[model samples]
Every structure is written in structure tokens, then in C-alpha cells.
Target: MDYQTLIVAVDGKVATVTLNRPDVRNAFNETTIAEITQVFRELGQNADVRTIVLAANGPAFCAGADLNWMKKMAGYTHEENRADAAQLAEMLHTIYTCPKPVVAKVQGDCYAGGMGLVAACDIAVAVEATNFCLSEVKLGLIPATISPYVILATGENAARRYFLTAERFSAQEAHRTGFVHQVVAADALDATVADIVKALVANSPNAVKEAKRLVQDVAGQPLTAELIADTAERIADIRSSEEGKEGVRSFLEKRKPNWLN
Candidate 1:
């Protein structure tokens, strides 16, 4: 699918969705939101695509809402604002729940709504030179739409500070706060993302998807007997499946798995 705001490409099992609006720092308008939602939905269902890389062009990863879009929002009624916010919420949810593991290649600065884009991904790799901020408060707005993701990426304590302060933080601070997984030099960004993609591609596709779902389903849930039984059942079910059988047999035989072949 063609996108006015994105560049999508597939090479082997890896699919890349790049934010293409570099001129405006790849900021999201309503159109950008819609296209992002559509692409992640499509890529999630594409059997040929195993891992996805969320990338951007230009010097900044994403600078939040497009200036023009925000200007348009200024005239909107409360109801219209709520509806507009819902679209952005849905867009983030799509990427967060997507079955394919997504790697955020944050090459430069990410702020406001842009931070949500990174937080929604399974893993985020940013350059050491990048700066990040949750500057919504400065604009007389709050990071309500992206709060769930941002809070999860950066703990509640960190969120309280950043959400209110709107202070610009360095890549190191983001890493220390556990927001981004890896922080490396600018030139090492591609190689770092590639290594992660290679790791994901080598894993069992069925298991990988199940693992992703497992975390989503089990995280923060109570340790009840029902939950324990559910997990046991999941492993039992997989162990008897064709892919599971092949995985074990190949390992036992000291050979590459069928999925690799």
C-alpha cells in the first residue's frame, strides 16, 4: 500500500515502516495516524514478514504532532478533540499489539507523541546523540494519549517527573530509565538494529508470536491457579504441535530447524 506519510519495504522476512515526513520531523497529522494504523495492521497479517523495523528518515525520529495538524485542532470542539485523540490512541494500540516483534530505530530526537511511537514498539534502539522529551505540558496539553505506553516504558516515578517537568533528557538518561533498550553511537544504529532483527528472524515464528502474546496476557496478572494452569496448558499444547516437534527434533539432530530452511 502507498502511504503519503510513510515508506514501507520488505526484504526477506523483515519489513520496515519508515516515517517519511522528515521535512516536518515526521510529525503525525490525521492522515499520518490513519496510514500508520493501516500499515501495521497489514504487516501483522503478512505471513512473509517475521520482524518489523520502525524507522525514520532525516535528523529527527519524530517531533510529535504536525504543526499544521495542531493548528487545525485549535479550532476543534471538545467532542471533535476527543474523537481526534481516539484515532491517535488506536494507532498506538495497533503497533503495540501487533504480532510481529517491532524494533524502533530512533536515530535522533523523539518528543511528545513521537515518544509514544517508540514506546509502542517491542524494542527501541536509539543513538547516543539523541534527545527525548515529554513536552506536552509546556504546550498547555498533557500526554494523555501516550501515557499508558510512556509510563510502561519509563516507570511511574520517572513519568511523574517528566510528565510534569517536560524537561529534555539525554539518550543516556532514557536508557538509565529503561525507556530505550540500547543506546549506541549514531553510525552503529543500523548495525545494532540489524543484529536484533537477525536474532528475531532466527527464532521459531510460531513460538515468537506466542511469546509476544504470552507477555501481553500474563504481565501484571495475579498468580492464581487459573493463570498457572493456563500457562501450563499453553506449553503443553505447543509441545505436541508440528512446529514444536520439528524444533526439538532438529536440535536433537544437530541440524538447522525447518523454519530456517
Candidate 2:
């Protein structure tokens, strides 16, 4: 689909969604947010797309909400503000729960909602020089909508400090806080993401999808009887499926997996 603020490209089994608004550092407005939501929803339903990459053009990955958009919203009524905020919230949620693995390629400054986008991705690779901040509170506003995704990415303790302080953190610190999966030099950013994409593409799409769901199902759960029983049932079902049989057969035959081959 054609978009003014973003670009969507599909190559083989990987689909890339790039934030194309660089003049304002890719800061999101209502139109951009809605475009992203619609594109992600489409990608999620496309069977040919096995994985997705979220990247942006320009020196800054994103600067959060557009200043002009914020200015326009300043005079909006409470009801109007709520509706607008809900749109942004739904966009974030759609990306977070997308079935296919989503990867973020962050090469520059990522602040506010930009940081939230990285947090929502399944994997994120950032440049070593990249800077991150949760600067919502500085403007007398809060990162309320992105809080759930950010808190899940970074723990409660880290979120409490950064959300309140609005301080800039380095790429290493972001990795430590669980936001970035890897950090590479600026020159190596593209290759790093490519390597990760290769690894992802090498895995079975169905297995990866199932694994993602399994992680979600077990997260925050104890090793209770019910949990164990649930997991056992899931495993049993998979083991009885065609994919599982092929996986075992390929392993014993010392040949490349069908998906990778």
C-alpha cells in the first residue's frame, strides 16, 4: 500500500516497514500512526510474510509525537484527546502482539514513543552510538500509552527511573535494560540486521510462531501443575504434527532442514 509517512517492502519471506518521515525526525502524527496500524495489520494477515523489520530513514529513528500534532491537541477536549490516545495505543498493541517476529533497526536517537516502538519489537538491533530516552515527562505529559510495552521490555525498576528522569541512555545501557538485543558500530548496523534476519529466516516459520506463543503463555506463570499440563499438551500436539516429524527425520538424516534448504 502507498503511504506518505512510511514505506512497506517485501523481499522473499521478509517484509520491511520503514518510517519515512525524516524532516521531523520521523515524529508520528495521526496520519502516520494510522498508516502504521493499517500496514502492520495487513502484514500480520499476509501468509507470505514470515518476519518483519521496522526501521527508519534519517539521523534520528524517531522523536516521538510530532510537536505540531501535540500543539494541535493542546486545545482538544478531553473526549477528543482520549480518542486520539486510543489510536496510538492500538497501534502499539498491534505491533507488540503480531504473530510473526518483528525486528527493530535503530540507528540514531530514539526518544519517547520511538523508544516504545523498539520495546514492542521481538528483537532490536541498534548502533553503538544510538541514544535513547523516555522524555515524555519533561513536557508535562506522560508515556502512559506506551508504558505497558516499555515496562514489559524493561523491568519495572528501570522504567520507574527512566520514565521519571527522562534521561538519555546509551545503547549499552539500553541492552542492559533489555531494550536492545545487540549493538553494532554505525557502519555495521545494516550487516548486523541482515545477519539476524538470516538467522530468523533459517528457522521454521511454524515453529517460530508456536515458540512465540509459548513464551507469551508461560510468561509470569509459575511451574504449577496446570502450567506443566498445558505445556505437555502443547508439546504433544506439535510432536504429532507433520512439521515435527519432518524436523526429526531431517535431523537423523544429517541434512539441512526443509525450511532452511
CA-lDDT, candidates in order:
0.96, 0.91
Per-residue lDDT, model 1, residue 151, is: 93
Q: Highest lDDT: which candidate?
A: 1
Cα TM-score per model: 0.98, 0.96
User: In angstroms, how far off is 87's CA in candidate 1?
Assistant: 0.8
How accurate locally is residue 107 in candidate 1, as Cα lDDT from 0 to 100?
Answer: 96
In angstroms, what RMSD does candidate 1 have relative to the true structure?
0.9
Global lDDT of model 2: 0.91
Candidate 2, residues 178-227, lDDT tens digits: the string is 88889899999999898888888887787888898898789889999999
Which runs of model 1 end up more than 4 angstroms from their true locations?
none
RMSD of each: 0.9, 1.3
lDDT of 1 by residue, 1-261 (tens): 679999999999999999999999989899999999999999999999999999999999999999999999999999999999999999999999999999999999999999999999999999999999999999999999999999989899999999999999999999999999999999899999999999999999999989999998997899999999999999998899888999999999999999997
Cα displacement (angstroms), candidate 2, residue 58, comes to 0.2
Instruction: Tell me the deviation in Å of residue 215 in model 2.
Output: 1.6
